[model samples]
Target: MTNTHQRPLRILLAKLGMDTHTVGITIIAHALREAGMEVIFTGLKQTPEMVAAAAIQEDVDVVGISTLSAGHTRNLPKLARLLREAGAGDKLLLAGGVIPEEDRPLLEEAGVDRTFTMGSDTRDIVAYLNEWWAQQLAADA
Candidate 1:
């Protein structure tokens, strides 16, 4: 959180499935970078497997999914499973977009570290990442 590691938090963002509405995703990516984190946008129409593989291959600190469709209800858990299968389950799994409040609990149960739904502020998200990262560092220590 204090930039003690020299390298910024590496984040990989992806949109799984055929939905190509990337406006929200791109905004998040830019906001995160502006907040001093390294971001990797994996683009639209990516499969869950590709997202997971890229996350592991890129050695990212977090894997973020941007969803605007109902597919997340099914795809999110699958991505979590794939990450777990690839031994990267412990890494942070973040998602944000137009997800419904009714589905948030399900996402958490499916292994999502956090979900920033509609109306969530970028400042709050940035603060959360700072706090969360600090906690991780302390826990490791």
Candidate 2:
């Protein structure tokens, strides 16, 4: 995939709320990096505010939150609101880990651009990101 920007696509991956799970997000970080994307892993125990601030300060193209503690309904929307409030409404917002099929609409209504359920292929994630980025570049062009 061709990156319109000189630098690789920048993405911020975070562990939101009280979720202690890191294995999935770690693997994702590695996969994104391997795909030549610049990844900023915010470690664990990040708040919606912190992630939003990092996303804006880092000028990332995407923000991904990983949760396995059932905080998706609460945290994802908060982060989305914060990002929009900070004028980053265009940044792709993604949720991963343990999200139920039923809650998908709530998340979408709250401005989450995508969700990757548990066991989602990292290759598919990479392809999705690349495709999304390409579309954004095309739109701009």
Candidate 3:
């Protein structure tokens, strides 16, 4: 779906912390790009602050984090707070990886807007973001 913004939605995807995984995020990046959103991949070993800085620099509409290590509990919240401090807190923050179901609520409490476990459908992720963008536009209108 298209919006009145007149530009494709921009998304920044990052592999934060010590997580060496890239396959899942790469696939997601391709899917989001295919859906007509501008996708930026930050590669591996990114700190939360670095990701936040890049997100602001890129003027992205969303910040998607892919984590597979235990550092998520430590990093996601820091990134969330950093975004708010940078005055970019309104950007959608999404996390997807090997996160356990029990920890999903914790991430949400820490400012993550959504959590998708491993094997989540890329189509669902795209649809969710599009729906969210539509809602944001409606709210702005």
Name model 1 segments beyond 4 Å from true.
Answer: 1-6
TM-score for each of the candidates: 0.92, 0.94, 0.93
Kindly list the per-residue Cα lDDT of model 2 for residues 1-141, writing each as its tens digit: 234555578899999978999999999999999999999988788999999999989889899999899999998999999999999998999999999999999999999999999999999999999998878777766
For model 3, how does the per-residue alpha-carbon lDDT over 68-90 read when each residue is reduced to its tens digit? 88788889999999999999988
**lDDT for residue 131 in candidate 2, whole number 0-100:** 90
Best candidate, lDDT-wise? 2
Question: Candidate 2: where are CA atoms >4 Å away?
Answer: 1-6
Q: In candidate 1, where is summed lDDT lowest over 10 consecutive residues?
A: 1-10
lDDT of each: 0.86, 0.91, 0.89
The better candidate by TM-score, 1 or 3, is 3
lDDT, residue 36, candidate 1:
94
By lDDT, rank the candidates, best first.
Answer: 2, 3, 1
